[model samples]
Target chain A: MTAVLCRHFGLHHMDIAEDIASDTFLKASEHWALNGVPDNPTAWLYTVARNKAKDYFKRTAIFETKVRNEIIPESIENEGEFDYNGRIIADSQLAMIFAVCNPANPSESQICLALQILCGFSVEEIADAFLTKIETIRKRLQRGRKNLRNNSFQITTLNETDIRSRLPIVLRTLYLLFNEGYFSKTSSKQVRIELCSEAMRLTLLLTENTLTNTPQVNALLALMCFQSSRLDARTDIRGEAILFDEQDKSRWDQSLIQRGNYYLVNATDRQEVSKYHLEAGIAYWHTAPADDSKWTHILQLYNQLIVVEYSPITALNRVFAFAKVHGKDKAIVEAEKLGLEQNSYYHALLGYLYAQTAAAKSIAHYEQAIQLTKSPTEKRTWQKEITLLRQDKR
Target chain B: MKEFALIFRLTDISDFQPSPEQMQERMNWLGSIAARNQLVDKGNTLLPVPGSAKTVKPDNVVTDGPYTEIKEFISGYIVIKAATIEEAVVIAKENPIFKIGGSIEVREVLKRD
Candidate 1:
């Protein structure tokens, strides 16, 4: 609602737009408590917010002149009616996302602003998502807003060129949002679901619009759907993290898997393949029943993924796949070549591979893994591995 | 149900100037309480020290106040309908002020007549 109001009253009046939005919620809270919530809560909120904005303009002479001259169109003002529906709200949100993703701001600031403004993430939630301090998140948000204001960036409909360049950042932000949800340090299931679902929701918005219905968008959506399908199996009944190999396949959501397949098919319609396409393929393989064929396919996809977009985590994951395809020794050699000694996952994989050969070496690697990670779950898993290795040695 | 005032006390944060996003979260928090029919008054934010504050002495001499000697001041207060002080405290615990290291005091209101 705030985004739409800002769109209506020029982005420069973001503060006013925010004030009006806050007032709308305040009014809703007071009124709803007295008289039960209205039948159409959203429409009710929209009407109240619009009226509040109108009142704001009427009372503030300066805003009235500014609205007339620079903000709302004269035709819409002459009509004395602001007709709004769900589509307008969605467009406003999309425009807000683009404005937040302005190339002027750093990528981190762009992601932080998008999560805070578009997804309604709290500062603390964003900080948790990014694995950063609350103060750092606050500073990023402040810098992002100041950059937006100084640039006088408006939320406008983008052309193809603009969309092509800006859409990647938007996709990257959503990807990170989803990853944060999937692998958050917090033990709360609700927070993880909220983050992942919010990311999927925003990505769905892009797919719905004609301008943004690109192959890469579909691929990312497919990737999220595939990953989300396994969310139920990602943890044990006690809420402890479950390794992918140990997860129960029956717990996975088949419907979501089907939906993922649908998007994956659509994603392949274009000749160009993005990193999302490769990741989605890898995710798809994970959904399949455990077999040598699936592991071989996954390893191939990882090979392509590394060539296209390399990250330390991805490289570590590839090593695990390499172990399945070849032997533990070969996988260990490849993992060591990456030189990610500081990464807990790297050490954990090495420990697993070494357990198949030398138990003493495996214990050392497991100890390193336990020492490198701050996550209690990871530490516990590595500790268990170390105990198992020692028992075997004895 | 009885009415209680949830007074927000804290060091001045006016200089911090919370971002719109932060303010929106606060409004959402207050809105949730109001939706539950507990909020009696939305309350107002107090001006910072050195702004429109005066302490009148017993002799009717007004002195510029909100003394800087004190580290904390009551920044705002919201009246809420609760069955007991405990209930009010539960509600106050959810206040956004705590996120910024502020504190809340839940005191019952004395009914007149």
Candidate 2:
């Protein structure tokens, strides 16, 4: 709705777009509680958003200086008409995304702006997801918004050339968005699911358009679908993180896995093997039957993934697969070389790898993991691992 | 079966913004009542906004304005048919508003028949 509203008025005030979106929710909460939810809640929200957008424009903008001033009649209320058409909203969203993914902003700002602008997440929500301070997120959003406003990014239908150049950056933002959700440290399962779904929804918007539907986009979408399939099984009844091995396979959403396979196949017809393609293949293997070959395939994908886009998380994960394929000792040798000492997952992985041969080292690593993680559930889980390892020690 | 109206009250709604999941949760609770065929009438919200009530006395004066000063106000109501007050209270107990610290008052509706 903010995107649509920005489009409605020639895209002058981005901050007003955000404020209106927030106010629309406030109105809906007040109105719906008093009047009950309307038959078409989505339509209701859109209408409220439209009104609030106009209200915000009137209240906040300096009418004499804004783009609206040129066309404004005596009563500016009816000057700009909001188009609620699905295609137009998609176009506006694309514009908003491209504006956020502007090469000038740092990669972190790009992801943060995408979360705030494209995904309709509050700054606080983005902060919660990143496990960073709200003030830091606020400043990042301010900087991103400032960059966008200074650039005067217009909300127009993207041309083919613009789509061609910007689509990769947009896809990367969504990819990181999905990963942020998939690998969240937050204990709230609902928050994780919401973030992942929002990413998928925006990516689906891209896939719906012919100009933007590229192989890498499809691959990223496929990867998200595959990971989201396991969202439910990734947590236990108590909201603690469940190890991949212990999670129930039946709980994985088969439908999402099927959708992922479809997209992955769609991705293969294209020549370029982006990191998303590799990651999608890896995620697909996770849904496959766990056998020795599965580990081998996953290990191979991780090897390619590291080469494609080497990050600490990918290296850590690659080490896990290496452990599965070769012996634990060899994997441990590789893992220790990464030197991700501050990472809880690294410590936890080390704990898992050492459990069999070196119980004392395993317990020590679990204790380190417990200390490194901020999540209470993760701390408790590592504590439990230490207890189990102690029993094995005797 | 006796008809009962469950009135929902909230302390503050000025800043209440229900997320998609919370909206879905509330809808699920409403769906459950309808599924049991106990839902009689989805009642209207008595207070349009917080403190939107108007009172008129015998004289021509009227007293009503923003209830911003008040701590609580009726948000809405829903009517359900149940065999007894206990059953009505059980239905009221299931309202999702309570999850956010709101309360529900379930009362039997009197009909002159």
Listed models, DockQ each: 0.01, 0.01
**lDDT value, residue A367 of candidate 2:** 89
- State the lDDT of candidate 2 residue by residue for B1-113, as single tens digits: 99998887877665245676565445445534553446677566565453667656577967674344577777778888898999888767767787788898988999889
Give residue A322's error in model 1 in angstroms. Answer: 0.9
List the pairs of residues colliding in candidate 2.
Answer: B51-B67
What is the Å distance of residue B13 in model 1 from its true position? 76
Query: What are the per-model C-alpha RMSD values against the true structure?
Result: 25.4, 27.1
lDDT (10s digit) by residue, model 2, range A1-394: 7777776664456676667778888888999999999998878888888777666556545664485665443334534555677777788887778777888788889999888777778888889898899999999988877877777766666788988888888888888788888878887777788889989998988888888888888998899999999999999877788899999999999999999999998888556999889989999999999776898778767765664554777778887887787789988876875657998889999999999999999888998898888888889989998888887764
**Top candidate when judged by TM-score against the true structure:** 1
> For model 1, how does the per-residue alpha-carbon lDDT over B1-113 read when each residue is reduced to its tens digit?
89998887877556236676466446545644553446677777765556567666687877674655676777777788887888788778766777777888888889889
Candidate 2 has a DockQ of 0.01
Model 2 ranges with Cα > 4 A deviation: A21-82, B1-113
Candidate 1 residue-wise lDDT, A8-121, digit = tens: 776776778878888889999999999999999999998998888877766565565676655544323622546578888888888887778888898889878888888878
What C-alpha lDDT do the candidate models reach, one value each?
A: 0.80, 0.79
| TM-scores for candidates 1 onward, in order | 0.73, 0.69
